[model samples]
Target: MKVTESPSYSTPEVSKVMDQSRRFIATASDRPEDIVEKADTEIIGLALQMLSDGTADQVIIVTNDIPLGEAAESLIPKYGFTADQVTWLTGGELAPELKEDFVSEFD
Candidate 1:
């Protein structure tokens, strides 16, 4: 599992969210899957790079935005990636299982 974020998260509010996530997963390392600017436009490319570089055979994109998920789906075939190779989570469906104490520290 890897985490990816836009460089724009350096701003105050987004940085707060990033910090909260880090603090919540205190034992985890602070490294990201990749740090790139404009994730909205670059994530698909990054995914391809990961695949081509053999860094990941499968990728699960966890996001809150519907369109971002859709865009990823549309680009999958164009990049010779298969449906099973990519997974999408547009909601926090996986969040419920996280430790409550860690989750409550955010939002």
Candidate 2:
């Protein structure tokens, strides 16, 4: 699990419960010097590491962030992952053009 430190989100609390299912929680730092502010960056990094290290056969990303999902999809193929091995879940299944509706649900 990837957790972002935010005033609005209780990441630590969530992480404790999620830890039972997954071993580690990739926590993000609140550094003003950082380029990226989202947890997606850490999530993507962990996913890539899992693939390259041969720890996971496939990586499934469950994010509402469109750019992060698209960026992850582009990089997964470089690690020898096929289309079937890389999956994105944004709440519901929808066509790429209709994904905007899916994203709106989070808003």
Candidate 3:
């Protein structure tokens, strides 16, 4: 339940994480040429930073963006986290009760 701002993009660590995330997204695509860019790099960079800095052992990136989730899943291991330690939850996959609450709050 902790909320924190994304790490500054100017930091070398954040920049590195963002580059890694973009590369992962491009590689995972069927049409790498069609992939323009990842707008969620900042979020992905922050998540990686938490794991890298020992701020969190596990991170669950809940989002409706499929590419964002895929990149996070693919790169988490490079940040020293196992697949089990990272989770990606799409909005549709949330439990029914929680889904309603989550949607309502956002709406």
**Number of the top candidate by lDDT?**
3
lDDT per residue (tens digit) for residues 9-106 in model 1? 33443344334333323323233424312444356555655665577898777665444455556555455679888777744556855434333211
Query: Which order, best to worst by TM-score?
Result: 3, 1, 2
Model 3, span 1-107: residue lDDT tens: 45888676776777887887777666655445335354577778888778777888888888866667888888767766799878999776766555664542112
Between prediction 1 and prediction 3, which has the larger TM-score?
Answer: 3
Model 2: per-residue Cα lDDT over 1-107, one tens digit each: 43433222234322322231122212222223233434655565556555555667787887666555665676556556687767777645534655655634213
In order, the Cα lDDT scores of the candidates are: 0.52, 0.51, 0.73
Clashing pairs in 3: none
Which residue runs of candidate 1 sit more than 4 Å off their true CA positions? 3-37, 97-107
Of 1 and 3, the candidate ahead on lDDT is 3
TM-score (C-alpha) between model 1 and the true structure: 0.53
Query: What is the descending lDDT order?
Result: 3, 1, 2
Q: TM-score for all predictions?
A: 0.53, 0.51, 0.70
Q: By the TM-score metric, which is better: model 2 or model 3?
A: 3
Model 3 CA lDDT for position 51: 79
